[model samples]
Target: MADILFQHEPLIRLGAFAGAFAAMALWELASPRRRQAIGRSVRWPGNLGVVVLDSLLVRLLFPTAAVGVALLAERHDWGLFAALSAPTWLAVVASVILLDLAIYLQHVMFHAVPALWRLHRMHHADLEFDTTTGVRFHPVEILLSMLLKLAAVAALGAPPVAVLVFEVVLNASSLFNHGNVRIPAGLDRALRWLVVTPDMHRVHHSVVPRETNSNFGFNLPWWDRLFGTYRAQPEAGHDAMTIGIEQFRDPRELRLDRMLLQPWRSDAGRYPIGRREPGG
Candidate 1:
């Protein structure tokens, strides 16, 4: 199973991404949670462009990707799980959970560190939140994230199948949690206990710095709650809350070129986690 998954990793990931993106797009059109001031025409081109660039760059830089690293680790019996002689089922489950936690920590670090925030802030800089917003990360940030995942896979001796599952599920959850579509309040409340809901994740994109610092989890909801970074809702409420950061309020920043240039263009601004004013 691991060999088959390793051989077909790209196709499996592409199919999953396409299916999830299409589903979320349709759902957004059908029942949007909030009215979009900016249409997809302006955002999708740049947002989608970033995903293409990030994917191509990852393939170019890390041909084997995380699954390949996992396979190598497994072959050599490397890392904690291998050393422990853990059962396959336990290893897979624990690896997935730990990988998710790593991502959660990475997200928080991006906000807390001034330099990293410069790269990650691009994702939060989207003027509108939607499924495309989920994929709108700066290329540098994506590369750094891939490097981290590779290290984590090797260190954990994560099974190739588990790495593949984590990659696919993380992609799907990013799209799902960033969806502009509405869920019934009751359903959203129930769903967030198991996974991060769109409403829960959207708070992280709120213009307010403190709100921006909260709800950093992309795949699992537990880490935010565990670390006490969870915010139930934007203070201004989701419908009325401003999106994007203070520096790039101009819609021109939505262009592909501008997004690529964002990290270099401005100072990290006041959004870096510890920059809050005394009263704030």
Candidate 2:
């Protein structure tokens, strides 16, 4: 079992990249704001490399933990392994939905918890919110998040099939939600009912603190709706809202070295000293 998983790791990783890349390419073609993103030379490699490294690191560090957890707590038992023979598509969809739900909780915690915010802020450090921006998380944040997700997978009893499917859905959605794409107004409104539409997600990455806090769900729109955290698109919405945390305004702050060392910098006197209240 472990051997099969290890052998397929590259293929699985590539599959995720393919999905994300397709969405990003399509979104770039459709969205007038493509230029707003950091641009391909920086965008493509940076986003791709970071996601791969982070995911691979997570997998290597926790070898089979996800699979083990899934096996032990799985509610349904088809056999000793519970190797259910459902269609792959079903497994994929189930996995995506479950993983996304877990992510929503983690995202909320990052904003609400002060210590987590210190690490998660690096994600918000981007001066822009584009497809590539979605993958620009701090390594520490990624590690911490993977640990939380390991627990979630165990609790949810997610199968390998589900994990595979979730990886694809996650990659694709992150690209779509973060891509500077503008879906047709009518289509976008309707789609947000089932999935996280770009319009809805754009609000989450808004420079305005109020806008930043809404729409944290990564895949479906259900959690945001159910939790009373949902925000509708602004009637007279600006196509471009400011992006990034105010504290990371300096040009040098974009550097990886600076980003890694950011928390240690005693800029406690900084205007946005810490995360201000959502609307602050």
Candidate 3:
């Protein structure tokens, strides 16, 4: 099963991405949670452009990605799980859990660190929250994230199957949780306990820094709850609260060129921790 999954990794990833994206997009059109702050024409192209670029660059730089690294580790008897002689199922489970935790922590660091936040803020700068917004990370940030995932896989000795499952699930979850579609309140309440739902993640995109800093988990909700960063809802209420950072509200900023240039632009004091107060 693992060998088959690994052999067809690219096809699996592409299919999952396409299916999830189409589902969320159709759901948004059917019953959008919020009126789009920017039209799909303006936002979708740029957001999509970044993901394309990131995918190309990552394939060029790390041909194998994290899954390949895991396979390599297994062959050489490298990494923690391999070294510990863990069972296959145990290693896979532990790998997924640990990888999710690592991502949660990495998200916190991106918001907390000034330099990294410059790259990461491009994601938060989307004038709206939707499925496309989930994929709108800067290429540099995406590259750095891939590097981090590779390192984590190496250290954990994660199974190749675990890495594939983690990647696919994380990708699908990002699209699902960042969607602008609405879920019934009762269902949302129960669903969020098991996974990070759209409502849960929307809080993290709130324009207010405090709300933006909360609910950083992409796949699992437990990390935020465990770390005391889980905010139930935006203080101003989800419908009334603004999305995007305070700094870049202009529609032109939503263009692919401007997004590519975001990291080098002035700080805008958009970062959450130890803010320097915009030219202070």
Number of the top-ranking candidate, with lDDT as the measure: 1
Clashes of each: 0, 0, 0
Q: What is the lDDT of residue 28 in candidate 3?
A: 94
Q: Model 2 reaches what TM-score against the true structure? A: 0.79
Better model by TM-score: candidate 2 vs candidate 3: 3
lDDT of 3 at 102: 100
- Per-residue accuracy of model 3 over 18-45 as CA lDDT, tens digit each: 9999999999999999887579998989
Across residues 165-199, which tens digit of lDDT does each residue of candidate 2 receive? 56566767877777777678899889998889777
- Indicate the TM-score of model 3: 0.96
Model 1, residue 134: C-alpha shift (Å): 0.4
TM-score, each model?
A: 0.99, 0.79, 0.96
Residue 137, candidate 3: how far off, in angstroms?
A: 0.6
**Model 1 Cα lDDT, one tens digit per residue, 45-102:** 9999999999999999999999999999999999899999999999999999999999
Query: Where does candidate 1 stray beyond 4 Å?
Result: none
Please give the distance, in angstroms, between residue 74's alpha carbon in candidate 2 and its true position after superposition. 5.8
Displacement of residue 240 (Cα, Å) in model 1 is 0.4
Error of 2 at 48 (Å): 4.9
Clashing pairs in 3: none
